[model samples]
Target: MTVSSDRSPVTDAGAPLDGFAVEGSEGSAAADIAIRQLRMLGAASPGPDVAVRGAGRARARAEAGSAGSLVLAADHARVACALDWAGPLALPLEDEPGVQAACGLMHVHGRSSGGPRPLAIDYASAVGGVLSAQGLLAALIGRLRGGAAELVRTSVAQAALISVGQYLAAATASGDERDAPAAPGGPPFTSADGVPFEIETFEAERWERFWSLLGADRAALARGWQPFQHRYAAAVCPLPPELHATAAARVFREAAGAAQAAGISIVRVHGAAGERRRSDAAEPPPWRLTGGSSDTPGPPPAPCRPGAGLPLDGLVVVESTRRVQGPLAGHLLRLLGAEVLRIEPPGGDPLRWVPPTVGTCSARFLALNRGKHVVEADLKTPEGRRQVRELTAGADVFLHNWAPGKAAVFGLDSADLFAVRPGLVYAHASGWGDARQAGAAMGGAEPLGTDFLVQAHSGLGGLVRPRGEEPAPSLMTLTDVLGGLLSAQGVLAGLLARCRGAGGIRVDSALYDGAALLTAAAPSGGARRPRWGPLHPPLRTGDGYLALGPHARSSPDRVARALGADRPAADAAAAVARLCRGDRAADVAERLRGAGLSATPVCTDLADLAADPRIAGALDTGGAAFVRSPWEFTS
Candidate 1:
């Protein structure tokens, strides 16, 4: 709980993770990376109370009773079958899964890319690792409060499911009205001179103005706004071809200048060299933490309620956030047992009325905001601001994803909130950590901190798409989800510090930071030259596609033997596809699993997810078809 920037305080009583152990599977980088991140944040002391073991050794260590808190990372299918949880219920099942570009991760990338194709880069695996880390942190907080040892488990598939939950929610909603088709198309428009870039603005007028300034077709401008604006929620933005044509007519600088004049933010998609330059630049940590004190201190930390099973039970979080990241963080906190009181604008969140609904609520909105309490408050008014302060006085945490500096405009910043709730764990899930720095990164114009733009600016656009394809950011709200996870993690860490007698703390997590973390972990070469592709694209079968997880690339001979094909030394995708083409996807998947490899039929349709046996137990199909909280808490 010490306030030094250099010290690790993410533990109970500032004690290291004395008995926590991680065992099983070498490529379970998610668990390893999560543990490593925690340790870097001071979860572990000098020596290793946190233990890690390779695959097949978990049984021996469990029997020995030396492994304390344990986290296991495996392929989505194995984890799903063993845990009987729907977890990720990945689209692309694969043999020998890891954080490779294929496997379950491919499904996520494909969703963002407008279909089920492999992302040239690794995203889901790293995200799953972060999810595992959050689970571990929540468990540690529980232990800090004198709860028994907790079991934390996650899979890459589960992580994938969590990321795509919003889409699934809308897709799985029952009733007469079907959600709109996920028609393929989106941004990062390529200019005439061959510079690719993304444009962003939440306001429709700005979008219209920017396009008109660039002499885009007037009819296309009017037709394109809704899809462009809703891309975050819809997972696709099929802009009219005329808009692309317009961008294609201008040079990069001319288009950029027009966008600047129109008050729209635009960023060039960084190539390999640009990605490397950005990667080498210093960036903020995933989440920045700072201690704060109230002139008037609040009561001492409350004791954990007796028999309360969830770590955050009895705590209250007042969440005022629009869009995905902040609300998702609040949702995670709610799942962890905090009573989340959501502050919506007058009337309600407009998104509540958007598209396919489960009852009166937007199924997509419900995906992130199902169980929270709600109160309408117009923050633009003084009374509304006063009401928020009153709510904060009784809350343990105040979380938001407001645009940078908006809080201060309303006098609702951390300093303002600390005045009311002295021990509040204030969290701001931001687009860019600092606008000035972000502006510098984009060469003077402060790029909008939206997901796609962040992806373009942070070198993800190049890495995400495969070679020979147009480089563009995955429009899946990727950084927003990652930012949300980081925000919740920060809140839990702050609360843990408070449980150990620390004062109020402020946590700021940014989409830019999340993008930076992913880029930093990727192999060098940025986007101009991708170092990896889908290790193995989903193999086509008689019935459907079968994914041979990342491990398939490692054990080609075994895979070849299992499929009765030659070892694929070259053209592995075509070879693997040919091997499975004669069999049903299920048959191919089963055969690979029998051969001691991870495999499953690719779940191309979200509507069919509830019926999938591997994860049916974890899904609640009575309403919207969203996966339950990924963590299974067992004391």
Candidate 2:
């Protein structure tokens, strides 16, 4: 096994580090193993550029002293450790196109051995996207002092979270007991704004808010409305616009300031994109990849075990993108270890103040703009565009959601940027592709709008077909995840080409594209799976959903028997519903799924399952909630 190492020395004498194989060629290990010899200079400002070193070299280094050693290996998508990491180091995920999850190496000196054991920090939450060496090293150091080797997991919608919750619950409880809510590492069923209600101080001759709103209504006062309100109810109180925005912008800050003065952890959480680093320290020097050559890494872990390989690393991405599509690409790329910077137009990305929501943010924006750096630069302006042009020059990858015509106006249509930013990997994410956006050969921006229409046009609704008695299929958040993956995948593949001097731009991700991708799943062996579903054939799992196979290539009787009654009748739905109502959802799900037949009650929200302690116990890492990143970086 070969691994990559950061700028530190090789602790052991196994073999000198080597690079990865190029994308198109293989079989020549000699060229693949050529290490980049350097005159050793200061770190670059562009950020650390990671490359693979044969795993043999990694083993040699891990054997050396347990400090100043940073190991970063690209497994194609998720990075892995060659050996246990043990020192102050900043391990950023590679900024390549396909990478999905980056890892921070954490080494806690073992208490008995008087040395630190390995630990890792997966910063998918509140990610600032600036993986500076100091910042990275600092986080690793903090973890060693007390941080657990956390497992950063990812789940799509409540479905993914529910399965995880059930697993944790089963792992924690003893015989017969089905419920446990206080389990450590479980998510709060409802984590409300912690502090209760507050009185807003007005600039005019005004009294406190609660005193004014309910003081006159003693009836309301009885319900704590006037004063003793359920702190939550008071907090949720709707205020007049003038007073609300004013107090919110200033009053909360003032109150929080006071609390902090008195030693409290009081802070407002902005959207992930707008979130700031815990420390102001400038982005650290980029890692110097002075050793090793080549680009493409090894194979990735199958979906069954995501730990096998990392798809992305050390790829530079500038997303001059917006709305859901562009930001979403940046978000997913961050997971894959891509260095993604979301360059916003002046006054920030239009998303900064879109959807006309409360509190200077949009709910949709918050969810989509995570894991990337948000910077204000108006591309519409000549100067702004020039600045962006400069930024993109060094960027190995670029993505945008603008229509081709409009993007072309700003020098981003197709491979135009490649002229200025040579050998760059580029992609465009759009709701409507050039075909749909065209109007009598006037195919452009004016015609494209509304994600809903995109959904409808792509036959997303048709994909649902119809069941016996259920309503039509609904719009799903999964579209965003899938679309985002498409765009990132394009960029990743482009980087792989560029790494070998074969770079070029490509296009991927459309609302229609996502719909088509889903539609493709309907077929197998070039024949479509019959839409015949009593919703889902009378089976153990019930309506609209069916069980998956054992992968063993044979029908195992053990699975059939464990599924209990194989025949699914109308009565079975009632039975499952009945069990769920009695809090037996966990037990029944486990027992049935244990049989290797796909089973689990459709969870409306992950909240309930997250609260179950049995589920929480299985996740005792830094995953504040039971939901976590799918890959664990164990080299």
Candidate 3:
């Protein structure tokens, strides 16, 4: 559906600007984040005529003829409504017996050394909202080209699936717990000043340097931790707290500094809140308009005939990327009916060899590259560069995630590619934005823009703390997932503008920028951060555990009655422990839910997820089970 022209952009000060505007149906942090991103894209706020409503009801109403391109943003419940699903939204981390079971969060959390609580963040919902917005924009763009208006849907459930898609694929492929190991844990070590720090060494040279810096005994090295993978595996295995404490006896800053100087990555664990960085005002917008007259090849490419199903039908994209972010963007486009050709180096994407292989392909690789065709080309070689340029001539979108200056070096930069295909949507995904911004942010160094480093740089580490403990990085690659979606958003926007007669544009999305947007709703200081802990902590039942939502705190009387306790709210922990000792988790959860409390039994393993009817239908069964992108379109 195409947006009505009445919508316009509005700033925080309430002044309406001249551009497309978006209005949210509900007031939610996730919705706010999505709107902020839209503003960054130069869209204005919607006028009064465009009444934004809950996505669930909107979809139902939309089907009845109010079908214009619509963007729906909400938490999981609203998403469930849009999909016409029964019951509450099954959040992966928020509730027990959630899709986390299918995604392997329970297994990983069980093995974590920190505590029983899983990584606490609404990342799935946040990312889902962003992706949903992107999908809406794509659908709207299609509508502009004469396609029927459609409802583009995304949910925390879908975001949850994307976050753990690789892990779930591995689990399904291996069909054995022992075969699918969790990613490394960035083992915690204590400094001499009693400060704890996490260290990550994913390379053999760096690992050796770390050991050498620590003056490790020869016997320790002989323990067979030479290979990088072995060290990664050893780091994640349960370690004694005392060992970390002893390691922390060294001066924290000094130790970290020394390790870093020797080319190791280390960060001290602290509870300090993340400092907000400057806006993108000094640099170009996350996605910018470029190559208008000087590089134009006349008007935008002619609209192609729409296909039967996907909104992006007949769109051709040439994707030159590896790893998660760029490939994920291409994957999303492919799901929406775009033809994506992944261009890899001679040896293929490095991730092709990542662990938990299904046949010859890594589960992670399979998850991201499922629908696309792939070809090998060395951009450094003249023949290979010529071949890529020839492909660009016929492609509508050119997507890549090369480092800042590598694009120009390889003659694949925006200026170069736009010269080849003046009407192409040139999209670049990176660790940071332009070279100046990235270099400045990294203290004049141009480091590789991997997911973990981007998380640290973007201040995500500061936002999540394990109650009373030091901050930890998200086990889920939150930044990578969001950054990828943002890239896809940029591409969609570019395509829409092109179709509207704007010349070819250059779209840039960075992991750092995406991370900033993820936490934009947070107050600068003194505002109460949402408590990561459950309002009612997990209760131990006879057979398993149950997680109850914080809303139950409002009616302590009801909670007490449901748990069969007289003063459960007074000493809630003890009361729940005493009352649930002999009851089954599923029974307690059902009873609490019946009493109007939000609660569910904690899923213990993949088997529980596989049995869930709601989750099973979403998994692709062609090979090892993996999630398909969460989108449904009607013409």
Best by TM-score: 1
lDDT tens string, model 3, 1-635? 01111222111111111235455546444455565656655655545533334444545643342112234332321211122111123432333224333344444444444322444444545665576567666666666666664555555556666766665676566523225343333444657777555555556667555655665554453332432243222214433333344355557766666566767655544332344343321222344444433235445645547554666888899999877789888998998779999898898877787666677777768888987888889898988998899999889999999877788898888878877787788888887666575556544454556555555555566564434555555544667777788788878877766765666677777876666655554454201234543343456779876666656645556776887875437666556666777999778767878787876566555435654665765677654777876776654
Query: lDDT ranking from best to worst?
Result: 1, 3, 2
| Number of colliding residue pairs in each model | 11, 58, 18
List the candidate 3 regions with Cα displacement exceeding 4 Å.
1-19, 48-111, 114-118, 174-185, 188-190, 194-202, 218-249, 266-273, 276-307, 434-444, 523-529, 532-537, 553-557, 566-570
lDDT of 1 by residue, 21-135 (tens): 4343344445445655565455433234333333233333322322112343222100110121124443334322332322234554566555456655556666766776677
- TM-score, each model? 0.86, 0.45, 0.82
- Candidate 2: segments with Cα more than 4 A from true spot: 1-313, 353-366, 436-450, 465-473, 524-583, 590-598, 609-635
- What's the true lDDT of residue 36 in model 2? 14
The runs of at least 3 residues in candidate 1 whose Cα sits more than 4 Å from the true structure, single-residue gaps closed, are 1-27, 45-105, 111-114, 272-284, 292-297, 524-535, 554-561, 565-575
Model 2 over residues 1-635: C-alpha lDDT tens digits? 01122433112211112231111012211111111111011112112343434423442443344211223232332121211120111221121100111110010001111221111111111011111111222122222223222112221122122212223322223233322222111000111233222222212223333323322233322333222111111111222333333333334445444333333222222111111211222221111111112232222111222332333444567887764556766765665555677887667765455332224553235445545777678777888778778887777667787765677787655456756765565677665444443222221222343333333333333333322311111222334444554455445434433333343435344554443444333223112212332212112223211222222113333333443546544554444433334344335446655664443333222233345443442233222233333323322
Best by lDDT: 1
How high is the lDDT of residue 498 in model 3?
Answer: 71
lDDT of each: 0.69, 0.34, 0.59
